[model samples]
Target: MASEKTNGEQEMPKKKKNRNEELKLHDLLNDVVSPILFPEPTNSAPLLHRIKTSLSRNAPLIPQASRNTARDTLLWTRAGSPLRPLLLISVGTITILALTGLLVFTLLFLFATINVVIVSLLISLAAAAGCLAIFFACVTVIYIAALLVAIFAISTVIFWTIVAITITTAWIGFFYTVWLVTRKSLGFAKQSLSVTSSAISTYSAAWGTRNLKHD
Candidate 1:
């Protein structure tokens, strides 16, 4: 009975140690892989709802000082955001009115300036046209004078050419007449010599034959 009691006491401690070891192993495995095998449940709620729940959950822990500061910041942001849009609208309205006034003033000024300058521009244009007409008239007169000079020069050249041709023709005719008279005189002299020679020869022959017959 004593040994059995001692054995049971020892076995009890051994069982407790083994059970503790198994429990420690199970806890380690759960810590390493529990999120992979079994994830935490997710709440499918709107952002505002989630934020409200989170604020409610943490509200008891947040101090009164932090809450007061948060309230003040929210109030300032609400007030400032509304003022910004009003200010921007007023600035845009002022800028549009200033630009419209400037455009109207510029148009009125341009119209007045054009009305003042148009008559002077027309008078200057007329003066330019008259100057151009005078210049063209002078050029036309010069062209006519040059044409007259050219015609006179051509007529003088033609008259001198005719005179030179007449003088040349007269010289040619005088030379031709002299040559004809010389040729006729030379032919007449040759015929007279031939006739004189023939007559003398016949007279000498007749005188010799009469002398021989008389002898």
Candidate 2:
């Protein structure tokens, strides 16, 4: 009986040791590989260390003050130019006003010609009735016909003359304005280009000198 009990005791200790080894293996797996497979937060030391190291190694290159200065220079240069907007607004306004005036004049002249034709026709009819019994009826008819033709011709000439004058004047003004604006824009562009070129040359020379000194 004693020998049997001693054997049981020995087997219990062996089983306990095996269970402790298995628990230790489970703990090791949970620490090293379980997070990859099961997404459970056991510890964050490794992740935090990686983040800190990355931030320390790769810092931002440009300083804040230099960045602000570059932005301010761009803004100031843009703000200093006033002629471009002014030219655009002036040209647009003039074009619209000229077109409107041309349209108004055309409509008014057309209506006036119609009214003149109607009045002349009414007067010719009245004279024809009054002179129908006279000996000069035929002559009167010829005179009235000629008068009507002349009136039509005169009205047509006047209308066309007005139109031609208006169109020519508007065109002349438009072209002159365009030429002036173009010349101004070209001058501005040349000046801007010159300034940009000068700035670039200066920066390049300074950079070259800096590099030479470093060498």
Candidate 2: stretches off by over 4 Å: 1-133
Q: Which one is best on lDDT?
A: 2
- Cα lDDT of candidate 1 equals 0.59
TM-score, per-candidate, Cα-based: 0.37, 0.36
Over the stretch 1-215, how does candidate 2's per-residue lDDT look in tens digits? 99999999999999965744444323433434444444437545576564554445332322433455446545655685444344444454555656665665566567656765665666666665665434344544666576566556656655665566556656666787788899999999999999999999999999999999999
Best by TM-score: 1
Q: List the residue pairs that clash in candidate 1.
A: none
Model 1 TM-score, all chains together: 0.37
Please give the lDDT score at residue 176 for candidate 2: 71
